[model samples]
Target: MAETVFATLTTELVHTRAWPSGHELETVVFSPIKGFCGPRRRHGRLGNVSPDAYEKTRHESLTHS
Candidate 1:
């Protein structure tokens, strides 16, 4: 598992989406200055998600619609 993950992580697969929770979910990594989508520039510039207002908005939108 580690080998596969490392291989995948090292590759150019940075930029994706996901569900609320799961292990077998597809993912993508981003850079600090690439995908800015929040009020504070710092929070929006992460390869990993921090699960804040943006996520809530997305989840609510998906669930309701």
Candidate 2:
């Protein structure tokens, strides 16, 4: 799982030029069985995630810009 996440993030970073060097990239891994709604377990430090309400807005800005 970690390897896959690293590969995906690295690929995105290489392909996308818009993201700045200091930009924060977040990776969230949810259990296949429990999913997001299940018990909240913290394996490591949590990272920043865009608010659900504004997620679509943020995505649109990125794609359109």
Candidate 3:
């Protein structure tokens, strides 16, 4: 799954940018990766909800039960 996502990202970046330097590529890549992997980013694996929200819901369910 990780490999697939990264491969897709790499393909998209290469197609969009003509020729990016190492620093420029790093800058462009970091933001999306940070957001995508961050808690606030919604995930399909988590029923299309953010990780924070999913964790909160799970905690609430466990506590309530």
Candidate 4:
């Protein structure tokens, strides 16, 4: 999951060059848990939603529950 996220973000950076002109690219790896369960659940739940919809749903879930 971390690999997939890194690869996806890296590809986007390469293609879009979205960062500031003089900024350096840095990668940060965060491991909150030892297994894939959390990532799998998040991916499964959020994967099909469009980004805008996902944000709305996520915000509501976090705020309400």
TM-score, candidate number 3: 0.47
lDDT agreement of model 2 with the native: 0.49
Question: What is the TM-score of each predicted model, taking all chains together?
Answer: 0.25, 0.27, 0.47, 0.29
Q: By TM-score, is 2 or 4 better?
A: 4
Q: Would you list the rank order by lDDT, best first?
A: 3, 4, 1, 2
Report the alpha-carbon TM-score of model 4 versus the true structure.
0.29
Q: All models: lDDT?
A: 0.51, 0.49, 0.86, 0.56
State which candidate has the highest lDDT.
3
lDDT of 1 by residue, 23-59 (tens): 3333233333244644334344443455465576689
TM-score winner, 1 or 3: 3
Residues 34-65, candidate 3: write the lDDT tens digits: 87778798999999999999999999999999
Per-residue lDDT of 1-65 in model 2, one digit per residue for the tens? Answer: 97997688677654665434443332222243255433343333233442442455678999999
The candidate scoring highest on TM-score is: 3
- RMSD to the true structure for each prediction, in A, is 13.5, 14.8, 6.0, 10.6
lDDT of 3: 0.86
- Model 1 misplaced stretches (Cα beyond 4 Å): 1-51
